[model samples]
Target chain A: MLYRARDLISITSFGEAYHNKPYLDRGDAESTAEPVCSTACDGASKTQARNRYPLRLERLIGRITELSGPAALEASCGLLREVQRRRGVPFVWILAHRLPPFAPDLAANGIDPQSIPFVFAPQPVAAAQAAERCLRSRAFELVLLDLTNQATGTNRGGGDRAAAAQRIDDAALGRLLRLCRQERAALLALTDRHGDLAGSLVFTRFAAARRKGSGRSGARERGGSDSCESGESSADYEYRVTLAKSKTGRPGAVYREVLRGPHGML
Target chain B: MAHTACCNLFEFALQVLLRRVPDWEAHPCVALAHDTPQARVLGCNAAAAELGVQPGMRYAAVLEFAPQVYAAGVSQAELHQHQQRVIAGLYALTDEVLCKPGDPGVLWANAAGFALLQGSPRAWAQQLSMRIERLGFRSRIVLGFTRFGSYLVSAAAQTPAVELLQSVEDERRKVAEVPLHAVVTSRQSRRRLARLGIRTAGALVQLPRSELRSRFGADVELVHRQALGECELPAQHAAVPVQPVASRRPPQPLISSEQILLETQLLLEALVQCLPRGECIAALTLQLSLDDRGQRRERIVPANPTEQVAVLLRLLRLRLERAVIDQPVSALRIEAELCRAAVQQHQLFRETVPERSGKQAVEAFAALRASLGEEAVRYVQLVPHHLPERRVQWRQGAGSQELSPRGSVQAQYADCPGTAQMVRRAFISPQPLARHLLRSGKLIGPYLLSCDWWQSPSRRLYYYYVMSPASDESTSALWVYYDLDRRRWMLQGTV
Candidate 1:
């Protein structure tokens, strides 16, 4: 089922923010909890550890494969490359970076990465925005959108604030919400931590016990960080990661889990 | 054997009178015997035969047959016009009509498919006779599988029996007593057969096949079948042509070209509406008679028959522009012969893209040709000669020439003058420009094209060059050439 923040409009932004992140990372977090990640990290060689990434990624790939269905995947070059390293299943990934609005050229950017095995499909504009538009147009199954700060138009030069805000255009987000309501396929929009889309279904990071130390103390000492000064603790962050939204069904509902570990996200 | 002949001579003459007088009802006499060639009474009935007036008797002779008879000559033209009207009226019943609009009116319509619609065959025949009578003409309908059989039955008609033949055997039985004229054969052949005691159709039919073949050619056997009233000719459906719809001409004399064209336009609109739909006439003959005298004028306009009334009118106007009318026309009659439909010949090549509209191009050519005479519209013609002027001759309009390609012939023309005489260029130049300019600014003079003096009295070197305007770089350069001996530049061609 489709999940979008627009569907859960009545859910208080701060109230639902705690559960949204984990909901987005359900698939990744699930696979990382599998036996392969833990055992491969403990006893296996570096080669074995590297190889186990696929085994963990296989589960993630299986989930993506389920979501892909009949309509093929439309993903960016970056997301496709990461998926390829993890799963080993070939897919079309176009380098569609920038495109004019409503131009039919977006259609040309669609590539089947499964064809010409292992060759990443690159183009002048990475087709992430195009892929999101394709999902809105219902041209494909599960589309992967990297809605990082830069893609959200926050990376534009600070001098022209109004122009930069206009460039952000938020129309793409609105279309994504509508697509999540209508499309049978899943829409997995990935955003890094500290992204401004707190109200949107955000994927949160839950480090494994081994490498959890890399940023665990920082989370504990976050009283100084804005997140803590705002009274948002690690538990509060976890709460925001789990809640999901759907148009027809009840909002802030739990759908599935996604696990990520040393190998990669499930 | 010839049947003993019987004709009512006086009755025939009297029937002629009743048709002529406009106010014969107001006349005092019980009957008016109007005649010059012969005489008979105007108002006579079936009982008048008791007074002894037979149809074939003369005016004075009819007095001997019947004492009250008088006489006057027949009005031939009026009688003929009446017959033509009767024939035209037959178009309502059937398209197939045969009319002999002369004396003793005969109209034959083959009703082959009418039997099913009109009940029995005899009923249809009776209905046909009643219909003819309503049209003011008495017709004896004798229908059969063949024309000869039907004609013989019509000749034999007495009081118009509705059912002339009952069965095939009955027809064969009557054939024995039929006269010699009933069979379609030469008189000499009939006599030869009669000498052998084969007097009747049945008698000939009974002869041995081998003996009959040896005595006469195969045609004799075919005739014997026809005489027996057995069908030899295929049943033919009659065709009655529709009466042409007429239009009123203008009040003033058609002196100017435009006035005549306008009158033609009005008439063509009426004519095209009168023609049957989906049928187009190829040639329409327009006959115009002068008012002053009976001096006749005629113009034949050939056109694409399937064109609309507007297109056809324009074509007629074009034709009239070409014709020189000698006298002022009093009456104009337009009669068109339906042109045969054009059948599209299937081409082998599949159409891959849009093509030039040939019909539009042809129409444009026709319009230009109408404004100009044969001399104005010229085509390039090629002759068998080495001389440049003689080798290429220009003809006007359509000409017979084989349009094909042979690469070897082009090479041969370039090699020798003798072989060049046989290699003919296209008779028409689609593009009439003179020359091709080399990349260099200087003009290479026209290629030497001179004829062999002994074969033909023609020699000239033709030069072709492109002339660019000195002042303007954007304007197109004109292709022109000069004849060396003529010492003048001529516009030879352009595309």
Candidate 2:
């Protein structure tokens, strides 16, 4: 009961800015905050619902953000579209030379593949530099610096750590953070789900991973909700994003988002 | 961390003549690098240019086109003197400036933090132009973000006065329109590009960097990179131009490659010690007296000026490996040009204050495009095709607009009502699909994907490869397919 009271208190403060309002006051969302709160509700398995609001990424604006996990790119793509479409801010995506994210999929996910610009850096250092250049040019309102070793064949522990160090150092992050604050733009650095690679001055760091059963190796969830598609494996997979660290104080808070329909929610 | 401006006193020698005669400005005149008929035209006045007298055209050839064109020659020493004076005038406005050696008349100045001191970046540029104009030479100043971008803008601008390009797209579009001949120094390379029908900077960029360099020359490859705007600029540290000479006379004549490398290392180590208080060695001119077998000379320039001995040593080792050190018993001399200047003098002019444009983020960066070539920065577009791979097409850099066809769907916000989903890790090329089938039993596939869906024997059975030995479904899985034509398995992406 005390835990439930704490959740009520949190819901009051975190949702204070909204007070059951639509994102950016777009006037499309329901006045009742039930739409967004339905999906990622804490301590209530019964709260899982058939519909929910778009994942809220406005919380990370003007921040030096890091997102990692199995579905990190998906979460980031959603954030980019949200900022780009709703807020009307231009953004640039810097990718590794080898890791070419499927553009059709990105377009399906609400991004105007034509509207966003991509910079290909071979290493983390180059990605950081390109991000810096875009920030300085004042053309982009958001910068996505993907330092994940998607191109590198090695996904083991040691290599990721070494690559992270080489790609993202304190000096580079310091400079990027200052620019984000000064320009009031968002900088998102993505990495593999594993490894503690968050650097200093990151205002918010989170991981968007698929929520599994109970343990390291547990069975898939038995029951399903209405929004989930037909068939066992074909249904939209639900992903849980947990805050790893934050300058905003909530370290363990989580949010949930679901995949689009098979034909991209058309 | 502000904008940079390029101050080009076009045709220094011609400008000098016009200033001295005051009447030459109205007449057709050309500044000859040499007075000989065979010598090329270094600079030409508007009147001369109007009469088809072009820079780099032979004076003898110009005689046929414009016989009345006046010719004058300025010595190298005099040109250097004027360049130094103009650089000096520029320093009065900004603290840092850069210019290539032997390539006088054009210089880049740091144009940041002037909104308070002067006004906008445009005003700072105006003051710079006025200061140079006060020196009696007409010039054009373009203020923009990168050193190369700004210089290109100033050189190619149609308007005569100062032009300010503030956005990245504007600078890229303007740079793309510059003709190949204006930037490329070699006439042979320019002709080679012209023969390929690649007239503009944008067209040259479409050609691969390595092929362009191999076929045309190193100069042509450089212009191609610049047009893309992804190229990392070299270090901008030049002041009080100091060339420190350090030499070594081996006690005995050596006959081995090892001895030469050892001797060179010692010389470089010694050179490192004597570099000025706050300057790094920019370039090293290594002259070896090869036992009266003539002198073997090589000038080694680091990507950026550095005081670190290791970085300098690595560059030296690379140069030595390629160099033939067959001859022995010689003296070695190394001349190092100063990379950066002592900041004490600059500090005196202005207070050390934090910049408003944010940390070094606004600082120009030699990014991925610098090493990976112009295609380094690219965007993807989905084309309607049966083959999954063929559906994706790549477009490079910030092209002014999309290359979509007529009646193609415009990508708009209103169309996409749902949030964006995860993107698979797509490989530019497919990798081998191995070890997944043998390990995990939870395979979902045989969707029967095919490049040519109508009727093609080259068919594929696609699958979501669950790498985990456990039966639980993972968030992200590898995307693999078995090809019927190749009779093998290949990994395409992650699902």
Candidate 3:
């Protein structure tokens, strides 16, 4: 069934709208349908689906992935390092009024700054439109948006403080999400620790906050030679990446990582 | 046979430049090859011509003579964009169109079918004129049976806004009467041909064809052939849009949605099999026949154009799943709009260097630039500069460059013993900092960065430290600098 016909039938059993009216599928019906039947399935299988979401991050294609925190750049880059390794995926970084992050730092990380393209959309509406055009092309696999700091436009004291949050309106967001899913392209938006991008449509939502009492500089742990060697690495700060909300994976789970460099993020 | 309508816009580049300012006639104006003063002039208005400014003179030299001259560069790309808009609008007016390749402003539309569909050719030509005028172009529309005939009539400077040719003889007579100074005629060629006692097109056409090329040039010969009706419209280039529509009337009504999907698959497969190589269906329109003989139409546009039946069928299935099927579907018609979906060169197995050859990606960047200005899209370019801001330059991206970096990228901690190196934000322009913010914590460094002493000298004393926040446990890393020349504290950037 395309929609949750059973739930609608059960909820309004007494009403004519339920029995007499023809069934029309809701857009988000499939996502909501799982919880009702979750009790019937084994916990292990449910966990498998939950844990599989992050494990498949490198190979998995689309969805709105939100990562915000002090070390969000590093965390998001760590995930992207694998995707770029696939070689030909086009990547674009979008900026809103503010200058992009330090390029040498981005080069220090595995990411080649020259390889990525940047879009300078000063206003919220323009940024969203630019992003929409990029996504609609169905060519870009990974699009990173800098919705971190408050954009300081021509006006001094403040610009639109909610510029980042209001970047993509609800209607635009809905369209972007659909385009992402259709293209199987990931739209990873990186925000600061105080970002207002904690929306429900986020396929994977998490944050990496720097733990207090920084760890001492220590020898590095290598998953392989794939780690960025150009960056002078030091285990100075430990970040606790907490999953606040995840439509694909289990929420509320915490993972710890020893960040190399303050944030040698992609 | 489709009757051709030729619309000519003379001095298109100059007119496009004039469109920018309303009272352009008040001043001497000229369009250049580029916006720079050194760029050569492309076209000029009457006032500029009166001031001794010619098409090939440098804009700076023109300014030397006429100091109050106004100038702007109408780039070929921009002109082509406007031409595309006109072509697209003409497509809306009529199906078949052949835009003159080099001459972006000149368009030939097949108005044969449209005369009946749109009531009359005069009204349609008026609409066409209004449409081009709205875009700030003065177009002369001439309707005739042949492309060369209509074009010749339209190119004549003294022709009316819209003229309808009654017959082929009338068109030839008008073409013969066209002066040597018609907008389409090359100025130098006109001068040379006039010296040979050929002041009109008829006099030029009377010359022997064997010696036409030897006497004049190949261009004149080509024009002579066109006038003689020897040259026809390039058949291969004539893009007559053919919409593929498939209709299926079932023996019985389909109650199950699955049945409809199964039928849709068959129809899509048939269409895909017939699709030409390198072409994909851009969009699909599904017309569901109701039991009462009414139609419910649903249109679907995929993220990317595809010829694959499965991808299109999946979208249709999704639509059908959500559709309100109040009555059984008795019949169906599927119309597909096709578009070119060719991908550029791809790497089969080589991953040696990062490359972006995706045609769609190129289109993506183009779409961005078309909506936003040229500076809207940018690419990061690393440069060897002492100042942090100068180290990286954000330049406009052409969307066709290689991603491989051959330049040396600076690494602060090239070989540090620490496993983690901190990241810092570099501001394009430093923000002013207060003395109180630095008082809360000990500064890490007085890193001396002074350079360009030979030029407009710049000296800076930089420091790095962590500042404790008043509200939270999260500490903020600050990078402040002291301008030795100004003797003031400024926040360079932050971590």
lDDT of 3 by residue, A1-266 (tens): 63688866666775643322211111235323332111111233543343222423553356776777766665565554445555667767777656567777766655567767778776656676677778877667777776666222212344356444455667776777888888767777777654455456667777767643234222323212233453342235544456777665576665444445543221
Q: Of the pair 2 and 3, which is ahead by lDDT?
A: 3
Tens digit of per-residue lDDT, candidate 3, span B146-219: 87788778878564498888888898898899886652246777788888888888887887899878877787
| Native-to-model Cα distance after best TM-score fit, residue A116 in candidate 3, in Å | 0.9
Candidate 2 lDDT score relative to the true structure: 0.64
Q: Over 4 Å off in model 1, which ranges?
A: A1-266, B1-228, B237-249, B274-279, B284-303, B317-337, B343-354, B357-360, B374-381, B385-495
- Model 1 has fnat of 0.00
Error of 1 at A24 (Å): 80
Question: Every model's Cα RMSD, please?
Answer: 34.8, 22.5, 21.5
Model 1 iRMS: 34.9
- The DockQ of predicted model 2 stands at 0.19
Residue B237, model 3: lDDT of 37
Candidate 3: segments with Cα more than 4 A from true spot: A1-60, A150-167, A211-235, A260-266, B1-357, B403-421, B434-442, B469-473
lDDT, residue B348, model 3: 47
Worst 10 residues of 3 chain B by lDDT: B410-419
Local accuracy of candidate 1 as per-residue lDDT tens digits, B1-495: 111111111222234455555344233222333444354434343544556654444556656555553345543433434444555555554446554322324456546565545676666666666765675445566555445555555655555444446555555566556665445356667787888887666677777666665677676777666665464443323244445545454566556567666776677778878765434565555666555665443333332335356665665676576577766666566766553344331234745532222232234333334433223223333355543334444444331111112234333322321110000111122123223333323343444555555654433444332233242211111223454555544433210
